[model samples]
Target: MSSGSPLLADLIEALRCLPGVGGKSAQRMAFHLLERERERGLKLADTLHEAMQRIGHCTRCRNFSEEPMCTICSNASRDRHLLCVVESPVDLAAIEQATGYRGQYFVLMGRLSPLDGLGPQELGLDLLSERLGEGEIEEMILATNPTVEGEATAHYLAQLARAAGIKPTRLAHGVPLGGELEYVDRGTLAHAFGSRLSVD
Candidate 1:
């Protein structure tokens, strides 16, 4: 807990909720916002509130959306027969920016982590299974992060895909072990997508 003015301390602690923010960083951000950019801070607060209130998960893909479906899922040009599973919306964006993949996506939003109380139900595997059973998807690509939990999630989804008669493929190892897709370079992402291997 912070020891300064109660409001300033609360602001610093709130900033710490952001990813990669530590105590000092949060303190710096709070001071910067309060002293140097009060208007920006107010705008930021308003935008955050508005966005949180309006944006929600896409009904089909679970990506952030203001509507029921995301733009990719709603686009007719994308291949409805192909679906890529990713650990988060950030990973999906990375792959889209780096590769020529025109398939729809399923953002798990998180991988299986039993210790964290994350499991099939948490990842909405049941929803994915329902989609697979619909016969619209011919191929399912596992693009989960290259972590242990990600690998386990991919393998589990692979079994579900195969049981539903859809081919499941895994991104190639061009992505370093335990590397996150959001941090991977475009070239590496493209190479990994191009060289994806069958997991069936």
Candidate 2:
């Protein structure tokens, strides 16, 4: 890499910004984009730029959407009375794909990490409280990840739900500790949702 061309080195370093991609992977990606897939790489770059410019947080659920409300939040057929709270849009997508959850969702965007400056405000807990106080939602499903921060966030949200006179429940422990919903198998996630326990 020391002997590599400066432009090529820059491309490889830029690719390293991607998650789970290391030096070797970034180098390979850079080489592939330059040598064999220049057209596709350009298209990818353009698409990413467009998406970044257009996509914004959904006003109702905090998920990414082009409109104020996400499709799930605006769909009248969905159960508005049941709100499934998730850590991120990816987690919400996983649950939607795996289970028959016809209810609405609220994406926290992240779990509570006070040391990292992530707290109730960062997670939009105040907006969630406002939504709950509207008296439409009957229950809140805590589907945060199985990490320590996720657990603490779930506990905090459960208390918030109780204050709003809404029942709170959690996903079953079928989702292993430290496992993310996006990586969990569809069958496992379905089972976990089916066997969820009340957090009353």
Model 2 error, position 84 (Å): 0.3
lDDT of 1: 0.92
Which residue segments of model 2 deviate by more than 4 Å?
Answer: 2-6, 174-200
- The pairs that clash in candidate 1 are none
Least lDDT summed over 10 consecutive residues: which range in candidate 2? 1-10
RMSD of every prediction? 6.6, 6.4
Q: Please give the CA lDDT of all the candidate structures.
A: 0.92, 0.92
lDDT, candidate 2, at 138:
95
Q: On a 0 to 1 TM-score scale, where does candidate 1 land against the true structure?
A: 0.75
lDDT of 2 by residue, 1-200 (tens): 77459988887898898999999999889888888999999999999889989999999999999898889889999998899999998899899899999999999999999999999999999999999999999989999998889989999999999998999999876888799999999877997899898999
Instruction: For model 1, state the Cα shift of residue 7 in Å.
Output: 3.8
| TM-score for each predicted model, relative to the true structure | 0.75, 0.79
